[model samples]
Target chain A: MDAARFRIRRAAGGIDADAKIINRATLSFVLALLGFGFWKSGFDPTVVWRGLLVIVREPDILINDYVALAGLGPAFVNAGLLALAAWGLLRVTGVLISGPALAAIFTVAGFSLFGKNPFNVWPIVVGVMIFTWVERRPFKDNIIVALFGTALAPIVSEFAFGIGIASPWNLLAGVVAGLAAGFFLTPVARGALDFTRGYNLYNIGFAAGFVGTVTMSALRAFNVPLSGGFAWAENGPDEILPFLALYFASMIVIGLVEDEDALPNLLDLLRTSGRLVSDYPRSFGIGATLLNMGLMGFTGSLLALAAGCDWNGPVVGGIFTLVGFSAFGKHPLNALPPMLGVMAAASLTPYGLEAPGSQLALLFSATLAPIAGAYGPVAGFIAGLLHLTLVHNVGHLHGGLDLYNNGFSGGMVAGIMVPMLDWIRERRRHEP
Target chain B: MNLDATQLMRCGDELAKYLYLRGSRRVRISYDFGEERSFCAISAPDYLLDEAERTRILKVFSGPIQPEIASYYGALAGRRRDGAEIELLGTMAELEDLMVTEGGGTQIVLSRREAEYFGKRKKR
Candidate 1:
């Protein structure tokens, strides 16, 4: 049955009676972020604008927390505005703001807190538009890919600001690099799915990793020195924790209020192996999807806090990405195992669980949730363990230009583990 | 639903490969272009699809046509012969019929309506 049919069946059963409510709910969520951001800034235009200017001028590599660069007010404002713009783009393209669309939107918002920005992201988006035009295909067909492909937005920032080139030429080179990255992203992303076989839900990250590696290689060939560092805000948890708790709690409340069958539908959703294309909104109702998203948000926050990590920009961004993907793939049942695997691995390694890298590994390891959903917790645990080690090492290859470094590592883990697991399963069946 | 001719052909290719893997040596594929809908039927005369197999295949094809997923990952449909591949094919097209002939052959018909295809295009 289609989503419309599913809705009709639910309505007939006297459960979820509303249709097209997810869009309105998503719009309201964006608006609330904007509202919170303005309130936090005391509605001072100068403060917000200055913060934004600082953010846009930054190189925005890995660990460049906007909160530390500017302040809490600008970070949230940037995230909220980017999310709003994404929502508007989807609307203009006639794309339904459903599970995958929401995933992309929230990811944009999440990464905006650290890496992506309004100025750096546009070149890549325009490049995708040009690709669509050249191919003579409707941009709507590839809008989600274009949105997610902004994982390489750092490439634009790096070329424009970080590299020591003259002003106009530097800007020109950055736009050209960004355009090339975006133009090739759709094809590369589609092909990269075969490598992981859809086990890694962040396929765009995997693709961006490859593109970033090439771009980095080209830059290094010209003797361009690339440096990596961190800009973490140590005092972020005090303010961020309360906001996250309230926001997630509201999601659960709204979900229950909207659908009588939200709990049952959520259970049904959890049973499926959340492989690629496992759209919760289309399979389950929006109410259940919202509930799942809320639950996953809390799960991510709990894991980070329990590991003694602050609710910094990257941590919050990771949590938001986890929450968004809950509607598409991740859920409490499947997402927990990989996180546990990362935590367990951190205990044995020299990197303490409280370290920023370890904290992020714990949260972003949920990219391998489909492994747990498909092959059970043990496989998921192993995938997460492997992902932690590889993620830390692979950043230099892309020079921290690829924001979803965990995703790149997760793809490698899936590509290696899935084939081995399948062979083992086949051998076990024959042995029996 | 808004599929081009190449995409429709890819759908046929996926069905062909699936049937080939399931002990169908000689698969016959035909297309019927009507005013409202375009139909592609792939039939295998040599293979007798059992009740369990028929039911499983029907379940795979019974899911909704997710245009968003199809547009993103549709190219991967026929490349792998895993359950996920078949499931992805399910999201691409609507199942019209699965019939067993008197000679114990299986014919599966999948469809895309011109109205839905053009409708979405016009919206663009």
Candidate 2:
């Protein structure tokens, strides 16, 4: 009995030690990548500081591309800092290092390059925390959604910074709007999950789109002018693409070192339908999930390259978000069909293959990968086609307040297509 | 069988009540004599039971008395919900749509003999 107890203790100790090492390595990797971006952009503290100040002060409405508005250095710093703060929050909360958390953190980093900024995103988080208190649940349960739900952060910025409202009143109104958005976002997001029934992995994005639309409509009713049109940067793929490739490749190597089981579990990861609540870390382990994320990032960049698109802020943002989501529900096998479908749709339409809209369609179209997983590749392809077509029109409803416009489109597509697919299958089953 | 139809009805009532507590509204419990199994299908269109909850319930299902029905139905003489008389031993099969049950909730089919064994032993 003594020997058995000793062996058990040793085993537990080894497991704990391994977990610590892995966590340390993963955190280091993120910081190092961000540091590289900072250095590569030729770090000047004063310029970066100025850029960050501009980011916070900007109205940050939809398509208000950060790369175009601010320089690359500041945007990188914003993303890195925003992501680091989130990482620190996780550490403070004692949340386990898991796939969903990783996805959320990286998404913050990615979107910061385009839309999210530290000043704009915090109020929503605070609102989510208030929701936890009201619901009498732990904050951990909602942290991931809170991070993802920042797609609507622009609404807060618009109210505070956009309309040229007077100083103190503008600040007050913005705070109120952000708090209200945060408070209501929890229930809306939870309830909206049933609409797509987990087929659309970007569930919060779907919910936030509706929220944004209503908010924008109310603002417009009060005679607040809504801003619309495409915002993009036409430079810097040459500098950014090489960095992204090396970063992802390094992630794969690190993942292999952490777990020999990564490659084998990757097969299992691909087999999963990637429905909601499919937390990969709890099942496949972190190493394999990270490997999948790296592969996804590489593929997204490759797709961008194939389309002759420059790696601008939004493009990189879209690619990084897609990569992060791979840990949740966007594997290569499932994600590829929709990407192809977007490319196909672009060729058929008047839109140039490398047009910003088309590039966005390609990158964000992966949100429908679950449609492929649930139905078939053909269904996924159709969903992608429908997404690009719908996305162009749906932005008007929200007035670009919804940052995850693709999520809104994906949810709509899934809601319509999944039921039809189920009906067809059910009918066929009876017929045979 | 010492367990009469009334007792069986009571057992079914217990299951229905339990499933309702688990957020399933419309439940249908049926017994298959030929296959010696009992099926409980709940009309839970949006029923999502996390893994931890699933594991807890599965443990109860495989135990001496299914906890939800144990107090009233499992205390009978020489009877247990663990299916001693029935070969299935009170196990739940994988969740699926077995024969187009209402509301798309999970269907758990167990041996009827086990359910009977849950109330009373067969008397010769």
Candidate 3:
């Protein structure tokens, strides 16, 4: 059965005991993570409110570095609130709480740690809603895509206040840009899928990257200097380390509580190629999916610590994204190869291993996990190497407008590599 | 408990009905009944046996049957460029020797006694 049908059946009183427990546990875990961030930020809701004002008023173009603008406490609080807002939207929409939805929610929260805030993310969201209204379709149809589509949200922030124009004109231009981005996203994302054929998990990211590129190019032609911005926080990892451990450990405990076969099921999930359309919640049950996500998060945190990287907003955001994707199409086996490949490139190239850009790339490299899953580890390593090399250069195309820069690079790498792998597999099958 | 000709026909009709409801089209079932065991071949264009339908059929076949006289074992055999072949084995006793393929399609050869079941029998 499809996810929609499964949800219907669940609602019709045939609820699986394991599924019920797992759903509650997953929601609780997210709420807890957010609460911890708030607590760590001294529980000052007013500070977060002020920080959010600062986040919105500024031009949040690519690499704007939210952590640098807002203090760590406020930035984390903004992320937490944004995640909660996404959760609330799911509730209001009466959408089934599934692995995919969880992934979307965590992604919002993760990106909130960096580029997304309640203010800028919503215009793109409303723009998507406008698309659905004009198309006369249910909002649920594009809810997931709309949330992920906020990769272009930076365009809204940049156009709104960054451009030197009078009040009404700047605001009008910003709204128009946001509406256009959201409107074009559906068709562009759908078309881009054929290019990757479901190999690159961040299909929307790739689409947004292209959209961002074209939009940025158009604006730049008129002499709008789209500055490529980047900054990282220099916070010590003292509190962040313990928080990461607890957050991931809680996920493991919740998984164990929800399912008896979580360990074996998680291992089974790992055996899959982590391809698109692989929903762990449906296949291995929600409990095992949560287990895999917890493990993935822990693994990401460990890698960051080993590289001597701080747990800043972007780094945490990247880790959150990797962990969230584990529910949809990521596993330890597939994710590790690309990450290690990035680390290798960092060491060999002029980039320092602990550089912010390299660390961000290392975490985002999980976007190419499908290659590792489908091919062997060696192929995965090659894809990762290619991704790191291309990622730094691709930013110039959009001038840092596309937030998921690694995703754009991953799509290109997969487009080039998967067909070759398919050809080789066919030939080997025919040989001898 | 060997099935009579009428019982054999009923089994085929019932199985075909099950497959048809689950999206299989142009299903063809060929059968041969011996004194002790029976052989049946069920083939349809591979498109009909999507992941969901395949899983459904396996569940239905393995599920308990009232007044059980025989147990069914299924293996996927030949594949057309378009679809695949599914074979079902019904017996009063289970086979001791089972050949397993890790990644290849499952194939179970018909015995000489059941050779007539080899040919396709189109259903109306």
Candidate 4:
């Protein structure tokens, strides 16, 4: 555990100690979960251990990977840092580690598989730490949210690495950029919560939009164009089948463990479409939420493997992110329909659905669950379809500063779709 | 818990809108602020509302501020006899939602006079 994870002041109930235990336990358990998927898929844990050794022993591959494909181990470390960070923050701050906080932590971890890596995470984390020092609050205070604020981790990594900045200077530039992004994001996230009225599930997504716009604009001054016209991620039956089974099974176990009798209520939650600020823990208890997180992890893992995605660095990180959000506002009921819609659109369009990164975009971009949750499945489907088309081009606008690409996509989806749907409803009402 | 009569009136309006949205026929908003017994009733079913839509209002309550949104529902939940249609207008979720959106206080009422002075309102 890093200092952030262990930096809590003592609480009345000794929750600090319990939190530490749980945090470490959570890390180990999640690692085991990843290890299981990795091992099951014929990637040996020992081999992965060897791979980890290789990563530390030889840094050249990472440098080489900068342009091609970033690996997953770095993501796990990044996410692990977040989890430790969250635990530390809660312990020190004495504020409970909220569902959103937990969800955010998981999201950081999961996305680490895809876009976030330890190399990228530090600059953002350090920036947040500096924010704590400046704010005069303990670094652990609100630390949980700050950890998720790392949605911009990619900003630091890619900027430092992608800009052709070499070696020590490359990391320095990335670190500076990342910390700036992190320092900037924390307050913006707090403020954006009000605008969305907690009606948008991904407040961070909304915050990232503005952040990306600013960062991208700043980058653009140098003619560093960040966003492009469009892009798509991948998906398929293989992923769908395995993930569907794993997710449902986990849900069943969760249902059974939490309350076999809780089904009607749990099912009712599904009927709700999981709108923003939906407190499943308050409504259904933490057990069910945990079950959801586990299932989401299983499902995301299956999605990754099915895509023939390497269990390497970036991919695992992405899976962890998807899994983490499962506990926050991205339940399958709230998330999958949009995914399906995106996939459906990808199939028919000139943009071949199986195109590189298209399915990944579609799968991960389900961050727009608030659209589906608030409006129902049809709108969710539509939002997903639109999200896929727009996500690619929007990233450059933020100059890769907004690390949550889907969040950028999500903000657009929410900003546009919410009003349009409301208008449609209001028009119908007025017409009749 | 000094009650804001004006704010109470706004709460009434929101309650009215909520009732309308739920596709219910009639809703009765009431207040039993010790000496005061006040209530507002809406009879239009065309005033339907989607549960997702809500207005935030600040209410003055005494004690732990246990606002019984259920009274409206209990009043409405029974049979619609003699063209009588009734449904629960406000619920715990509404109160919690209102509290979150409004970010106000639910002051404790130690006495009736204090109730009238603090967060106190009775809709009957």
Candidate 5:
């Protein structure tokens, strides 16, 4: 009995050690992003401050790249700071930084380059906090949801600055709206999962889309004039490409340094369908999880470059999101089919391969990688094709208020496909 | 290791559902409590699971406990048809036993301990 107890204790210790490594790696990435940002701005405090002001004041709707609006330095700084704050919140709440936590933090950082900002994301988080208080649950329980709930950060910015509202009233309205969105997000997101049945990895995105749609409808009814536009950074691939290569390569190196069996473990990981709650850090250890993340990041980058797409803000944001989710429900094998489907759609449709929207669709379509993982690659390709067709049109529903537009679209695609695929499989099984 | 009543019930529910899908018409679940540990044992007589299926079940049930993932997705436990929720169950409780009975039946025991439970509670 003592030997059995000791074995259990030793196993628990191993899990703890892996968790610590993941936490450290995530923190190191955050610091590197911060240092890179400062270096890019030549350590000019004035430039960073000015750029940050521009980022905060902008109506950060869909296609609004902070890199273009405020330059590369402030954009990176904003992302790094937001991610750091998110990581700090998890630590303070006594939440273990696991695979999902890593995904949420990296996602917060990634989207900050395009939509999320320090000023606008807090209201929604505070709202989630309020929710936990109401439910009498610990804040740590819903911290991941709070981080992902920032998908609606643009709602705050749009309400505060875009609707032509004047002064403090606009800011007040934005805060109230953000709080309301966050308050309902948890319950709605939980319910939303049933709609997709865990096929769509970004469950919060689907819920936020519903919230954003209703909010947009209300704004439209009030005769609010919402003008849509796009802001993409066209230059800087020379710098961005090398930086990404080094960052992703470092992840692989770290993985190899941490674990001797990372390669075999990663192969084992790729064999399983990346369904929700597929916590790779726990299943394959943090070492293999990190290796998968780096490989997925490189796959996304190579896909964009091969398609003749420029390395822009949204493009980088898309790749970053892919990297983050790699530890959760994505890998190169499962993700590639959907991405290829998006690339094929771009080639066939009027949306050219180099188009910003098409490039993003290619990367974000990995949200449906579980489809390919569960079904076959052919089904995944179909999902990706459908995602491209629908994602372009759904933004008008939310009026670009949701940053995870691909998630919203992926939910619809999954909802449509899963039932039919199940029926087909059932019929085939019975035919024998 | 000491799960609340609700969590323990969920563990039983997930096991029952998993067994039901695998052709077990009746599942017997019993609980045991002690000062140091608590356990739930789910048993089915003359179970028909093959070696491959048994291996897969054991692998998933023996996976590490991930409380964070459980907190976010626990609501879906026992509601999924693809056995994914069983994965979530593995994240909440430890597998204690997967043994064959004299009648060629299967009994699986899941356990939680007071020490680890209080340790986590203190960390929280």
Candidate 6:
């Protein structure tokens, strides 16, 4: 019956309250993929299933393992799920969720376990929802803003738990701040676009910079403690790799079920800018998009593996994100140079070419795929080199306040590099 | 105003349909600037455009607004054009200019600068 309901290309707006049906199907299929990975990792299917069941029922009991698994698996799952949530929000509201919105959701979600969570994120969502009501436009219309708008999720969460405020005061101030953040987000996003121009993709990073700046100020004015974070991971490739396989496999399958012709559409996807409003589902159908996604995922995953980077939580999240953006703008044609440049730079420097930090630099820096897409391969290589350097060091500028370090770094890289690149090109043109 | 002839006529017809939908029957338009600036304007009675009807007309101008435009509208809604003296409000100049260009059943008048300046703003 569930299969009957969501017959791939046969239905529109699927994933309804027929939750059990899809849930069962998704769960079974997901677990099957999981089982294959665990088997490959030498775990019996029965044992893996029992462990996962316990993991699901009591997340805190397996909090250590679950968080470890979540840190890696959830990046993709969160981004994919965030996308589905956007899709659902769009389907229900008739608004087209913007690319920036999708990226924002993924970015914030990737940071959630440590910094953001369902509790903190809700206020931001609620705030944005209120703005939609007042504007007389369906919430979906501002999809990009709504999604990218979640950078403030940390503010919400920090307000909820970080401060020494009373529980009631904490929740109240936290939620109110989020709503105010949401209310002002649309206009602020619109207002800030000009300050940097289109060179920066993470306009929300720019928005978040302002937000975090103001938030830090407000927190400072009052007596509130908002500072510091810890790196939490128990580096284990054996456990993490299987989880990565399951998540990517599920995405590939979902994409496959939807694409009618997997082959040609994969080719066509490369031709697109992968910018906002890129509806690969509509343009290429399910099968092709899936194929492309799978290939991209594999390629990105392999890059992480070959780089010998640890397959812990954050790195996996970064890899999943790079692969997902293949549809948006991170095509192999464009993405390779930055990864190559970064690797080249790492190999020569004190940085270990095969290190997690190095891989993280290369992976997240792929967000500047447009440099490759916009300029020639040379510029992209340069952009990647520039990104690799800046991304590693830029976190401190925001005081790790802006969680989309790639975006924050991407903005700076694109902002500084593109103009200089253009000047150089112009000089070359003017020369004999 | 500098649009190709067919594009101009097509724009005119859309204005006519919009005016017709809003219950107007006759209209005229004039341009004060050069051929670059010379164009038509559509005039219709106020609120003669019901909500849906008004929206249909508004969609044409929303076009591919870059973030700059989106932000400009966000911040400058009620402020005049950047270099002009009119000190118009919000996106009023844009809304008015769009009406003038859709020249089938209405008349619109723009100052010399506005006549030449309607579509000048790009992404940056």
Per-prediction DockQ, in order? 0.26, 0.03, 0.02, 0.04, 0.24, 0.05
Quick one: best lDDT, which candidate?
5
Question: Backbone clashes in each candidate structure, one number apiece?
Answer: 0, 3, 1, 64, 3, 19
Clashing pairs in 3: B46-B83
* Candidate 4 C-alpha lDDT tens digits along B36-82: 43333333323432222321121111002212212111222222211
Off by over 4 Å in 6: A1-87, A96-114, A133-136, A195-199, A217-224, A246-261, A273-279, A347-358, A427-432, B1-124
Task: State the TM-score for model 2.
Answer: 0.76
TM-score of chain B of each: 0.80, 0.45, 0.42, 0.29, 0.76, 0.40
- Per-model TM values vs. the true structure: 0.88, 0.76, 0.77, 0.63, 0.90, 0.63
DockQ of 1: 0.26
lDDT per residue for candidate 2 within A269-381, as digits (tens), equals 78766655344554455667768888998899988988888677788888878877876778998899888999898888877576677788799998889888767899889
Chain A only: list TM-scores of all candidates: 0.95, 0.93, 0.93, 0.73, 0.96, 0.74
Off by over 4 Å in 1: A1-19, A227-229, B1-6, B13-28, B32-38, B43-67, B79-87, B95-107, B112-124
- How far residue A317's Cα lies from its native spot in candidate 5, in Å, is 0.8
lDDT of 4 by residue, A337-380 (tens): 78777677777776655554455565576677767776788998
DockQ comparison, 2 vs 3, better candidate: 2
TM-score of model number 3: 0.77
**Pairs clashing within candidate 2:** B36-B112, B37-B111, B37-B112
CAPRI quality level assigned to candidate 5 from its DockQ score:
acceptable
Worst 10 residues of 3 chain B by lDDT: B71-80
Candidate 4 chain A has its poorest 10 consecutive residues by lDDT at A1-10
Residue-level lDDT tens digits of model 6 in A361-415: 7777676666676667788788878877776676555444555566767777776
Model 1 reaches an interface RMSD of 7.3
Task: Compare the candidates by DockQ and give the number of the best one.
Answer: 1
